[model samples]
Target: MANNDDKSQSKNKPFFEVQKVENEDGLGDIFFGVDDETTKFPDYVVDFKDEIEYFISVIQLLYGDTKSESLYKKYYERLFTIADLAFNSPQEKVKLAERSLHKLKSELTTSVGQRIRTKLLMDYLKLAIWPSIIAIIIVLLGDSVLTCVLAFLGKGTENIYISSLGLISIAAMAGGWISTATETRNLAFVDIVSVINNQRGILVRLIFINLFSIFAAILMIAGFLKINIGGLDSLQIVDSPTVALAFGFALGFLDKVFVDRVEAKLSKTEAK
Candidate 1:
């Protein structure tokens, strides 16, 4: 009688539980539980002794093993499914499909959904950055060298002094474009995009830079023509308009650099 009583008591003890997966019936079964927890980030998912142990720990957390797991799996599957459909669809249907997917994402409130969205955003940024990167490379190498070469060649022309100054101005314009291109490309990275775009609130600045470049190019062409029409030996610094233009441009550039540095510092303070 005592042995039977002891056996009954043991059976009634609370069982440590893992996950409830479908055994044979459409319902789940709880395997024996052993506790395991993870602290690492997504790039490194945690390893477990067994499925039962893993599920048990997950179940223990808020929205843990049960609802959270199901929610994540469902959202992740949905996100990928929608993405696949969007990609395979015709161009005309792409925007519509993306809207539909976005709606589906909005319905989700779980951590899993948030993570999936973050990944999607990163992918989008990677695509955006490529063009800006290419532009930067082209401006840095192509424009920089060409402007300098053109300016040096201007020395042999009739207005040698003026042409040289014009060439230097072109180089400065190239430098500004190179910086803009670089900044835009940097914005493609997920970590820095917001900061880059935020400070870019002044869209007019880009227009001004482009206009400056155009003006500089025009000046260089005019200076070259003037030099070829006159004799290089007769070229005088006092008569050169390029000198004033180059000086003004250089001063403006320095001012811009100073302002940008100050703004960056303020932004950092605000962030903190």
Candidate 2:
């Protein structure tokens, strides 16, 4: 009982006390959060009690002593989105702050348009690995699924021509679905709000990716990847359009580690 009482007494000591000063004319501005009453917050700071500390901390962490109106507007928009989310977890705000800081640092030497494009590509490829695999499975399953479509249309599945009808439709749908779920994690409204809105460009790239993956899968399944082990053909695992789809999906998902970034650098070099 005494130990518990002592702990309670210690906690009763204020983390901070709101400061106020008295003058003959009136009372001075009261400080509610900071140690000193004169400490003022940036206009971008959100007023939510749950997030106020985090917002202030992030502002200080990112800007340090060098504050700017541009940063204020940026942080204001981001903080507003953080407070608007349904679930108020601090982790999301912290993650956003970290990424924003990193993005700002990386963009220091890049032109404005180039920086925007880079940021978009980075977000597009985030959390794409396993999701890409799932998308490939959907595409590969397309061939088998065509039989069901044929049966529904009163056609027999035994007819090879009928089962192969609308052959590429399933792969297209799988790519579309992958683009839809690329949210990655909770972020500010403006961050990834229209991640797939550039539909034509995205679809074109994904199509190329899918084609390349199919090509690579054929070689790999044929023992072309040069593994000397027996029974290690791609058909031993990735047999149909569904299985072959994995290679293309991997290409897109691993674009950062593969062709996309390589192409980007080559373009930059050519421009230079």
Tell me, by TM-score, which candidate is best.
2
TM-score of 2: 0.27
lDDT of 1 by residue, 74-122 (tens): 5445544444343333321334545665465345323333343344344
CA lDDT, every prediction?
0.40, 0.42
Give the runs in model 2 whose Cα sits over 4 Å from its true position: 1-176, 184-197, 226-272
TM-score of each: 0.21, 0.27
How would you encode candidate 2's per-residue C-alpha lDDT over 1-272 as one tens digit per residue?
Answer: 99998777554433333333322423122233433532443333323333434443444333333345466455544544433331133222433444554454334313233433445455445433444555546445754777778888998776332111122223433543454345423334233224324432554555555555444444455554422223332443343444334433444455344455445655877898
Candidate 2 RMSD to the correct structure: 18.2
Q: By lDDT, who's the top model here?
A: 2
Worst 10 residues of 1 by lDDT: 40-49
